[model samples]
Target: MTKKIGEPEKDMSFLDHVEELRWHLVRSSAAIFIFGIIAFLMKDFIFNKIIFAPKDPDFITYRAFCKVSRFFGTDGLCIDKIPFTLQSLEMGEQFSVHIWISITVGFIIAFPFIIWEFWKFISPGLYEKERKGAVAFIIVSSFLFFVGVLFGYYVITPLSVNFLGNYSVSELVERNIKINSYISLLRSSVLASGLIFELPIVMYFLTKMGLITPDFLKQYRKHALVIVLILSAVITPPDIVSQVIVSIPILILYEVSIFISKVVLKNELKKELKNG
Candidate 1:
């Protein structure tokens, strides 16, 4: 009998598996650190250009919004000023924020490699067909993550900044946005969106485990819509446009997840039929 690819061809002890996982984690961490160093060196471009892009009126999203507003003859969508200034009050706040931001950026930059390492570790337990899908898994997951990051940066971040940056309980109180606060918002928006975009991947695993089916997704789609709306509200500002913008992609992802579950179930059934 021929041994399958990724199969050890011999039973490995628990300690051996643990050692393998540790090495995979070590490699993933090294990749993150290398990317982080690069990000740290490019602080000027990262912070001034990328992180702070949404604050400027000429940001790509803002420009698109302006053009759309003009075409519709509606002045409501045009954002002229984000009525807040970012300030660092604590003496070490800027340094701390810089380090954290670089680390986060590094993780984002190295995400694909990290995923590859994880796949390598897990692939040994998967079937030959599943092992063959490694490249597709990494590519699709990476593409989805980057897309989510861009959506958060260009859409959710701007809307939140515009709303919170301008919102004032009273005319007496001026918005003095702290450096840490701003960075936190930016980090959360990007990271949260990136993870949320992995819905289909999550569904595939759940279906494989026989935990959820496509019928379940369809039956509870209304409930999912309500949850998505609540999630949009939590992530975005209190504006309808921002909420709608965030909700749309998430809803689409949910539908795609359902389709993924259906496919997974179909494949499993076919496998069982062939074996029987």
Candidate 2:
């Protein structure tokens, strides 16, 4: 058995691997379609509540920020309203949004099956022990996605909305955000975070490829920190607190990735020693 995903098996030809991959993709697409149907049927809950959630002043993030401001005895996040109106600018805009949003929702909901498909495609080449651990792939990936979504919704989306909505050159300018633009912000934040949260998984695959090493991660530790901080700054507002909050989690994940990489390398070394 091979050590990780994408490693070719001894008996498996290139065409065989391609055929296997094709099936995996097909199954994953089917899962997404199934979930999309469900999302299409649940229009009221998806549209009226979840999708439009951040636009409402009574959103959870706003309430939490207001509480924090009150607890400090002064004021910070005490916004009366978001001060922006979302409008559809095209005749088919609303309908287009509905279709795409349903597809996106379907994709998110069917993520576990997608991961399973990926695992099935690759796990055939892994060692038995590694293959066993791959069973947790779907669960961990789904958990990370949910956490990232929450982070984007409560932290990223609200901060972005507040900053961009309130930002003005003069009193003459009014902020009337296009519905697509607003949704783009929300979608980007969520998808970006969701992908970022898979840092550990990325590290695992890289380690297997020998593209990443624990010693290398440790040697360039300061450099990685700088990059992480810069990324945090890019994703978040200019405030130190927000950047720190985002950077801290990523640093933790990097450290965890280092540890996981080390563990894997250690086991491989031990197996090599035994073979020798």
Candidate 3:
């Protein structure tokens, strides 16, 4: 029943809340756009070096896989080359993709700032103790996102490029990979994995809201494992090695989410006991 600081001793009208949200959005958007411009300026390095790195046989992921295969006395996991070339069909498609990719990269680079802006918008509604966790929220979320992006880039992307790039229905037909299509694959892999890696954060909130519990997660462990495998297959190659590599991290994240739910529940119970 304590009045929140900056509550003005009066309830804010709906329009006032909307106005506040609009400024947060504006700031977040500005951050993304500024970083986008920086990415646009480095178009050459972004495109040829970072974006297209997975298409090269000697990419770090491929080299690591080759070394691992050699250690195992098998070449099955080694990727020799990606057998497709990227081409833009439409006149302005390449330019359009360039602009969009820059924007996407900017969003990724400015993620921490965006999250901070969001936290600021929501923090006023939270208790002082809850607001104190904002820093941890941003740090953990950003760390998971970057890890997912790196995993998608280094592991999933290479497996996908190697498999689909070399796949042929018939020897007579050659695969012509469109520029936008290739970019789309890369974008989906990185962004989807990054978002998926926020499992623990999601679980924490769900636990706080009384919507989920550690027992619930534990009961559904088998189902979650099946779903994780399906997701891995969707993103990476159909091969066991690639699917297993992707699935391992996701499975670990699920376990982590369960642990987080337990911790949140324990804290909630402690707070209830103290209040009572």
Candidate 4:
């Protein structure tokens, strides 16, 4: 992609900037397609093991929960089957699901490269120091994203499937869930966490731009807690225990972000003093 040129005041024409962005979009699309093809070829691994895993009684998450419950002398997660069965109403439903799921999988695997392409596009406009410090952007961001995805897949998704799938009013009422519904839950949980784990990165940029400060974060600490609790409720099952458990790590991340903001502010001050 062509670099954005000219000074801050005399920017590249809007069309020129758009043209440059177009090329980046094109490259990113091609990358996603390439990865999608790879995912399509791995159908057995993707579907049997990964996608349908939560439906199995002996899935790793269920086993882990069972172990925890046995140790604590509480109710365990072991079950013979989910009360629900997945079905496709449309003729092309399975094929459509396969293609879309493959593309999303492609996006996840190609995420680092996509972020690198974004950084490349924006690097030309950044000061040298800013660019240097951001050399690890793709690696760090990708690591956080994968961590979030794992958390979602292993913890959140399983908990949800177990709780919701087994919940019933009576034996007369059987749950017949759709494939789309199940996949949607898994996808949303994974993608949301993947993006949420970039919290520190988002804070870092705002800190660098002087748009946010440690003091600001500290001032709104209680408010942040409420927001976090609300967010936890939104994403997780309606159980308070589950919400609290998930919120803990996220709150910890916010605290860490505050520390990072403080360090960044101090460094900025030192640089100013040195220049002066």
Candidate 5:
């Protein structure tokens, strides 16, 4: 059984702890399955409205880019169309893709519940004060993840689709993009951005564990910039605008991580001094 908040802590054997974890996993999986079924039922909206939105020339991101270009007295940034066709060659490809896409959407939608399960499993090991911060942690983490997802969907996906879809090495080569390939690109972008945005949270926990310090982050800031640029290049299309846009937020997150580490260390120091 799940422990209620503010209840007295109970000690358990290793096997008992494993049993507790099993239940948490079961519940989290159940939540994902339920959401997946809902996504399966909403196939049309999930596919045409969301997964394929970046390919449209009139997607919000593209239109915003066009407006920015017009403000600068140029229409060069405007995309008229994505010069590629998405096709499925195999007979069972569409059905398989549909099932996988539903599961992916379900995972995204159920992320908060997954995090809650994670917190509950771990909170028993934390101090009373730390356990009380569960609500804050869940809210902040979920907010960052969703923001990252939107950034990927709106900013990164459109830029990449526009660049790669228009790229041509030879007139003889036709851009018949496989449906699986297109979906893979979109999935990677959205999921990668969501995880990348968790840098500060990761730093906080690392600091608590004495694994990292603010000074360490500061000293490696230049190296981190290089890595971020390389990562940006990998995730985004080979364009300066796309790389810069992606890099800016990641760098900001790195800086925010440093600050979070500093705060965590300071709090720890205060606790040590009080105890001493």
Candidate 6:
């Protein structure tokens, strides 16, 4: 028989545990599928308002950058236009892109449900006190993910699109970007940023399992900075301004992870003392 929620986990056999996990995966997949359908139905909004928005000179990010540039007594950051045209070179490319974009949107919209399913699978192994923090974990993680998505969309995506779209090797060269390539860049930026923002949660769990400690994180702080800069360079456009902007938030997240690890370790120590 399948183990019900709140049932004692001790009674579950190995097979039963596998069965439970399978059900959680099924539900998560179903949620993603349902959301994907919804996204597929909203084609105009997704394509025109979201996917193509960054290419416009009057986009919110571009406007904001222009204001900042003007405030600094220069129009260096002002974007006039993105000098590129998106083309679909294959017959079924547009259809394929539509399906993939819908799936990506579905996954993003269903992220909370996916996290809940994952928590359900693992919560059985945690202590009661730890389990009680489930709601907080879900809320904080989801919030951070959304914030990171917005940051990627508004900051990194614009910087990258503007620079790459306008770049030219020579006056004779024209930029005709493939739709697949453009979408791929945007998707990677958004998803990578969202996952990177979960640093604190990952640190807490690693600390709880005694796999890592705050000292370990602190000792490698400089190393982490180097890695963050490297990561920023890889993700954003090859410009000092773009790389620095991306690196700052990631470095902040790393520091926050260290603090989270410290707190988790202290709490673990207190619990051990009480038991001893």
State in Å the error of residue 238, model 5.
Answer: 1.5
Count of backbone clashes, every candidate in sequence: 0, 0, 0, 0, 0, 0
- Give one digit per residue, the lDDT tens place, for model 5 in 5-85: 545466678998899899999999999999999999999999999999899998999999999999999999987889999
lDDT tens per residue, model 1, 160-187: 8888888889999988899899989989
lDDT winner between 2 and 4, please give it.
4
* Cα-based lDDT for every prediction: 0.90, 0.82, 0.88, 0.85, 0.92, 0.91
82-197 in candidate 6: lDDT tens per residue? Answer: 88999999999999999999998998899899999999999877777778888998999888888888888999999999999998999898799999999999999998998899
Model 2 has an lDDT value of 0.82
TM-score of each: 0.95, 0.91, 0.95, 0.92, 0.95, 0.96
Highest lDDT: which candidate?
5
lDDT tens digits by residue: candidate 2, 136-231: 877887888878777877788888777777777888978888888887788787777777888888888888878989999999989999999998
Error of 1 at 46 (Å): 0.4
TM-score of 1: 0.95
Candidate 6 backbone collisions, by pair: none
Residue-wise lDDT of candidate 3 within 104-130, one digit each (tens)? 999999999988998888777777778
Give the poorly placed runs of model 6, Cα more than 4 Å off.
1-13
Rank list by lDDT? 5, 6, 1, 3, 4, 2
Winner on lDDT (5 vs 6): 5
Between candidates 4 and 5, the lDDT winner = 5
Query: How many residue-pair clashes does candidate 3 contain?
Result: 0
